[model samples]
Target chain A: MESLLSPVILFFALGALAAFARSDLAVPEPLSKALSLYLMCAIGLKGGVLVADNGFTTELFLAAAGGLALSCLIPFGAFVALRRIGKLDATNAAAVAAHYGSVSVVTFIAGNQILSDAGMAPAGYMIAVLALMETPAIIVGLFLARRNAALTFQPRQDLLRETLLNGSVVLLTGSFAIGLVVGKAGFVPIAPVFETGFTGLLCLFMLDMGLLAARRLLHARRLTLHLVLLAIVFPVINGTIGCALGAVLRLDTGTTTALGILAASASYIAVPAAMRLALPKADAGLYLAMSLAITFPFNITLGIPLYSMLAKLMV
Target chain B: MVISVPHRKIEILVDAPLLRRLRQLASEAGVSGYTLQPTLGGDGDQGRWLDDQVTGGAGSKVVFTTIIDAAGAADLLSVLEPLLDEYGLMVTSSAVEVISARS
Candidate 1:
């Protein structure tokens, strides 16, 4: 309940309310983009600072490997569910599967924020995990789509560029690297912007995200009831699996919860562009409706706390 | 008096991610130049989408405009036809008078 009532979450609710009420509230596109960049940078730097303090640990490698494996493998399960249960055709199913397999940056940020407030702040290496988990599912999804006889596969340089070097991946990884190089002492000057102002900026960003999600949901014609249910269900199942994986690996509770959050979250930004380029025949509306509208709202509002509770149970 | 030359103005409303492909097709069709403009939001066969979407390139679209000779327009349309159905691209070409020097 406390998690649900947090200012960031409340602002998100407010944005959704405004959208549902047909209010004209909007975030400027450039400002929204800027906010996203700021958040990524802040996350990366903080993660780097923590790593600087902790040095190299075996846990980081274990988490990274687990995250990579989950990313590579989860799409297969999602592909099947989307195909058999949701009755999505091959291309759309594959596209949607890729989104499920990838991580949502904002969701991870929100989950991290909630956990930190609860005094379970996850390890910094989870940021690295977040960056690593962005692209592999896209590859799996393309493979799944290609297996269908009707879909034609073409190798394009731009698709490769978009998938691997998308803006979020680049900024997140680059900032992480910058933080590593700078370390804690070097981070002092910029701490005010990235640390002190993070939650407030996140609140503003959440407002925009709420508006985007609800507005997209309102306009979703391709989304079916089955698809919506799957959107919610995917996170719970995958997140639980993630929590189990973390516990089996004997990670701390916060890191375990963070892993669960990553597994459960769906990509809205990076994978969508890749899908547009690679799976052009796929229904963007359907996939976006599922990921941005359904899964995202579910995670921020309810899924985050649920995963945290599940993490406690496992770890 | 300035003389206006007849040309076909090709305008394509396409998803932002497809802008690169559109530009490549335009170049392939021998168009010398084109302009891209962002759209606010609109409802169409696929439903409504807003430009400010945080999902980045998926829901956002751009208007790609180019003025070219009739043959060039025909070539562009021919190249784009294959992708039109798959991408749901909205393409239109109209006869227009352009100031020859500016064009």
Candidate 2:
């Protein structure tokens, strides 16, 4: 209950409400993008400072490997479920599977807030986990999509370049590196904007996210009940397994919960672009609606708390 | 002074990812050149769509227009026809009299 009432969460809720009511409320695109960059930088620096304090250990390596493992494995699970449960053909199933397999950067940022509110600090190296998780799902998704079919369409030469150098990944990893370099002493000068002002900026970004998510949810006709149920269920099943993986791997509770959230998140941004490029015949409406409308909202409002609870129990 | 050579103007509104392939196909079909324009959003069979959002969803809606000689346009259509059956693309072409002056 207390978790649900956190200010950042509430602001997210309010933004969602305004959107549902069809309010004209908005955050400018440039401003929203800038805030996103600021938040990523702030997060990266915080993590870097922590690593500078704690120093490197084998655990960081293990956590990163765990993240890569989940990103690769979850799509196979999704492909099976989509094939058996959703009864989608190879292309559509693969498309949907890819989405479920990748991490949402926005969700990770939101998860950071939830963990902070819960008095847990996620490891900065988790940003690497976040970055590493993006591509494997895409590879797995494309392979599954083309598994049984005669391939005709070839993706653009820039597809891999776009995926690896996506704005979000670049910004997140760039900040992480800077954070490591700057460490604690450097954290002080920028603390005013990146620290004290962080929450306010987060609220603004959440507001924009809420509006986008709600507006997208309004056009949900293409999502069937089976797909919708799978959308909700995938996160829970995958999230639990992920949490357990983190616990077994002996990650701290915060990092464990972060892992669960990353595993559970559905990529709306990166995967969608890749799918459009690679799987032209796949149903864009079906996949996008599920990730943006159903899965994203659930993770924002309820899934975060649930994952945190499981992380607490396991840790 | 201007020359009035006959040509065909081909315009296609397709998801952005398809733009590159379409460009390549147009080039192979011998188009002189092409222009890719971004639309804010529009209504279609699937529903309403917007390019306004910066979310991952934003990149899919685009308009690709190319002009080529009439024979070349027909060849391009032949290439595009099969591709269209598989992707969500709306294509239209019309005969145009080129009104530009060139030596």
Q: Against the true structure, whose lDDT is highest?
A: 1
Residue pairs clashing in model 1 are: none
Worst 10 residues of 1 chain A by lDDT: A148-157
Candidate 1 ranges beyond 4 A from true positions: A153-155, B100-103
Q: What is the C-alpha RMSD of each candidate to the true structure, in Å?
A: 1.6, 2.7
Query: Candidates' lDDT values, in order?
Result: 0.91, 0.82
Can you write out model 2's per-residue Cα lDDT over A252-282, one digit (the tens) per residue? 9999999999999998877888787778777
Question: Candidate 2: where are CA atoms >4 Å away?
Answer: B1-6, B21-33, B57-59, B71-82, B97-103
| TM-score of candidate 2 against the unseen true structure | 0.90
- Chain B, candidate 1: TM? 0.92
lDDT of 1 at A130: 97
lDDT of 2 by residue, B1-103 (tens): 7879888898998777567677777777777678888776666666666564455433457788887887888898998986786776799999988888877
